[model samples]
Target: MAGGYVVGVLTETDNLNDLARGIAAGWGMKEADIPRLAQSLGQPQLQAQLAQGLQDFSDDNATDFFVIKATGTGAQTRYRAYTAIQIWPDSAFPVTRNVAGSAAAPNTLRIFSDFQCPYCKQLWDTALPEWERQPNVYRTAHYQFPLDFHKNAFSAAEASECAGAQGKFWPYADVLFDQFSSWTRLDPKDVSGRFSTYAKTAGLDTAAFKTCLGQRTFKASVEAQYKAGVALGVRGTPTVFLNGIKLMDYRSAEEQAVVQAITSATPSAASIIDARVKSLR
Candidate 1:
């Protein structure tokens, strides 16, 4: 073992244990030998082997050979490989953030998301239904990420969070993601006016939302979300955290697989989203 720790070989096979054992056996070893092999692969002693393997290659050619390939969840995998295990000391959620069900209900599963991100929309539209259907599962919280590159992103984030002040965060988020394509296609100069129209459509007080945006009431809150992302080493849109587990590597896996990874560590909670909404109301 490398430093006396077993290295897990994660795979996509449904019969993972069996596959792992078979692979080990094929190498003329026991199932338990897999971890040892992984550890050896990472040990300092293996460096000489790697160096010898590249002895005949030029510097540039050797560098090309060492380039890491995207295996599973492309961006998510890259993010996780780089940022996992690094803890953020300063990241904190809003005190009044959405709560899960009462003591009778399950704990909250807060999600930090940016409305401008297509991946965020995908998670919302696709994987969310499975968790929503699961009893005693999770409650989601939305944090704003108006990426600097997307000119209209900040306004949408501000609008959604402003709606949170009026007890309509999720509804606002839904509308923003649902109409994201249309909303973002508008001229940047027209974003504010169109956002106001969206707020009204979501049954929110358009005037209050406008005031909140004008005063930059949620600006610091928005910055805090970005800071949390930066502190956690977020480099792209749709960076999400399930409980405290940040899913930066999200490729190759389907929605159900992703959900399973998050839910694996927590017990299912009853009607998490509905309960949180009721709590907000």
Candidate 2:
């Protein structure tokens, strides 16, 4: 147990009833009397543990729970313990070769987003201004993960990719997201035409943009990006990974979380991209 946190592991066959019976046996009590013992004890910690155990058993394979407590000399000093039965999985999204900053930058922010996601637009609005101010500190790479529910999202992703081929991906994305509501609600057949207009508005060649859209030039690549995000366990848009660490609750205080993450990250002597590539060998 580290920092007052303990992870209890159970095999696939273990059930909550078995766990309760085992606890009763440890206290030299009949299994039927466990409920009375629990009430008599009246410990919040025990109650929480029992609840978590029951939940874990119901979930069937693996689950996690957290215990938080205040400690140390200062009242604000708190310790959090994360208890889990298995190691959390890591994301396998590939390193992006295309980005706004140089590969030599120490910090890298990989954003998995969808054009039609409102939360992603909110995150973009909240985080980009601050991020652009610190251009030298970190590089930003964007990946598309259009959800299946959003009928027009996949086409929008493809449109952005096509614009990217003409060196207008970021601008096209900005316009696409800015006009999300208008395009997303339109009939599916008309969404592609709207993207062509957006491309023109972003100052791209209208004819080429229309041709690209008609041909669906980047469909495979856009689908590939979405698949990569799914493989990385991305359930929603605007999932940001900083220096390879997924930032949980980033929306609570988006800019501060991003800045703090970038600031606290340990700087290495070699470029992050180079080190990552070397480790793969």
Candidate 3:
């Protein structure tokens, strides 16, 4: 088995306890900090196991290493690794669904999403809270980017927007996602009746909401968002942007880098690539 393994070490650590304290204080680093780690192991594999724990070490007190073996036939392969650091800025969030953070901690992270998309639901129900806790990091703005393939997306977005006009965009959006499985499964022509029920369940003025839906009152607003999404290079559902920059996919190392980048506020070039990559994942 002619192959190679990669290991990372923190230079300033004297012992395991020191390492633990450094991590707790957010001063400790990760394996990806090592240069060319991704080039050697591909990004998906890199993100999958970046936080490997050291099980056994010869000098436990003085040793701090994270090793990853590359299984292949290349005895003469050169070894290299690079680390990228990011800085996040503290700024006032001028816009958000809720204004809890100020310029000292900007809370704005705009999301371009389609209510009918499953991945969007996953992001909203799962990753959103993690980001939400960092109120100083970003305030989120939700936009409608209904996909054409989804029969009910436009209607659903308009409904949510109308709900927003009533001061309930978030709640309406939540309800839409909660009911997505049922609504998306229904036949397109038969969906309005179910949508009416959803609106009622979401605490909309059922009659007026139904009337608006029947007349497609908010359709133009939804279309406007669609046009805006196209102009911004959004081709699918669950597209996200931090400030004005598009985020990468969920499974990308770049995503993890963006997490660190957003948390810190100063985006390194590599971190920006990671953010955009996470969007694809």
Query: lDDT winner among the candidates?
Result: 2
Candidate 1 lDDT: 0.53
Question: Which of the numbered candidates is closest to the native, going by highest TM-score?
Answer: 2
Candidate 2 weakest ten by summed lDDT: 55-64
lDDT, candidate 3, 1-281, per-residue tens: 00111112222332323333333233244644434323434454542443231122222221121222222223432222121222222231122232223445543455778877899999989877777677676566677888889888887887776677667777677777887788888887888888778777778888887788788887877787777766555677787655444555743546545444444444444354345323322
TM-score of 1: 0.56
Candidate 2's displacement at residue 274, Å, is 17
Question: What C-alpha lDDT do the candidate models reach, one value each?
Answer: 0.53, 0.62, 0.55
Question: What are the models' TM-scores?
Answer: 0.56, 0.61, 0.54
Model 1: per-residue lDDT, tens digit, 1-281? 11222112222222324433433443346666777654543444543443233112112211101111123232332100110121122144544453333323242444556777788789889865555564375555556656788877877887777888888876777788889898888887788887888889888988898998778798788887777656455556676555443454433245324444433333222123223223322
lDDT of 2 by residue, 173-197 (tens): 8898788779989999888878888
Better of 2 and 3 by TM-score: 2
Which parts of model 1 have CA positions greater than 4 angstroms off? Answer: 1-108, 248-281
In model 2, the clashing pairs are none
